[model samples]
Structure formats: structure tokens, C-alpha cells
Target: MSKYGLGSPLKVVKKPGETLTLSCRGSGSSFGCCSMHWIRQQAGKPLVWMGCVNSDSSGNDYSESFKSRTEIIRDNSKSMVYLKLSGLTAEDSAVYYCARNSL
Candidate 1:
């Protein structure tokens, strides 16, 4: 899991229409060349592709469930990369995860 890392355990509780942000880190040459994808999976459910940011710095949410409700903002203030997702809902109550698309 060192190829890419998410900081600490994620346990977010927010009211409907709130925002959610997730940050992840990769070692040198670990993730800079890969596409970053944000995903959500509710308990006993399958993983849903929420959004993706290409290595070239462009991205969008591909899920119909997330269209217009999802926003992907890339943060480069630190060496690590961060993605900010806003406009959350009760349906967004699920496990959030980040993965690098090396394929």
C-alpha cells in the first residue's frame, strides 16, 4: 500500500449538502505518472467510480450518480496531492478511497 497512501482512517460524518475532502501521498515516482481516481463503496456494495484526475492534470466525475454533485479540485500546495469533493448527500455515506491508475 506504500505505492500510494491515504492519511489515517477515514470516518466522515456530515449533514446532507456538505462537502468532503480527501488527501493522499505517494513516494517519489510512485504516483506522479498515474491517473488518480476517487471512488466510493457503501457497506455490502460495489465500488463506484466517482471521479478521476489524469496525470496531465485534467479530470472529471464519470458517475451519473455524481454528475453535477461532484467536484474534483487538485491541490499541489504540498508534495502530496489532494482532491476536494464537495456537495455531498446522505447517499454519499460510504467508504471513500483513492487509487492510482498505473494501467
Candidate 2:
């Protein structure tokens, strides 16, 4: 594996009012030592910051637009993070991304 790698599905399809969970996994010496963040980009729109979970799973910070409907979780042992969005709608259709930052 690469020094630092992240993976997620290339495509996902969901319907309104449904719930969706997207997973991101990382591999590297420092993979689980920092926060993981989620972002999305829609057609003709700039990327939107969704939220993030601290590395130790102690806290979270979410954008106001997503504060009520989104939840973030991390599993350090597995080097994975998850973003769960509830009450999905057409507005949620976009390309999602997972990113990390040094603590």
C-alpha cells in the first residue's frame, strides 16, 4: 500500500428520505493519528464542508447545514471513518470526499 491512501466507492445511489452511510479507509503509519473530514461537490458548485471527527473520537464539528442530519464516526483500530447522512434528498446528490489533517 502507499504511504498514505484513502478509499471510497466511486459511485453511490440513494433516494429521498433514505439514509446513506459512506465509508473511507486509510492506510499508512499515520493514518489514524489525525482528524478525518468529509466534503462534497455538486455540479457547478464549489466543495461544501460536511463535518469531521477527531482522531480520538472525542469530538465532532459539522457545518450548520448538515449539523442535524449528518453523523461522523471513526474506527481507529480499522483505520476507517464513516459519514452517515439521514433524510437524504436530491440536494444530497454529489461527489463526496474524505480528507485528513495533521493534529
Q: Could you estimate the TM-score for every candidate?
A: 0.78, 0.90
- Model 2 regions more than 4 Å off: 1-9
lDDT of 2 at 11: 77
Candidate 1, 1-103: lDDT as tens digits: 1135666777867877777776776556545576767787888999888777667566654577676666655544343556565677677788777777664
Candidate 1 lDDT at 77 equals 35
Regions of candidate 1 where Cα sits further than 4 Å from its true position:
1-3, 75-79
- The global C-alpha lDDT for each of the candidates, from Candidate 1 onward, is 0.66, 0.85
RMSD of each: 2.8, 3.1
TM-score between model 1 and native: 0.78
Q: Clash number for every model?
A: 0, 0
Q: For model 2, which pairs clash?
A: none
Q: Which consecutive 10 residues in model 2 have the weakest lDDT in total?
A: 1-10
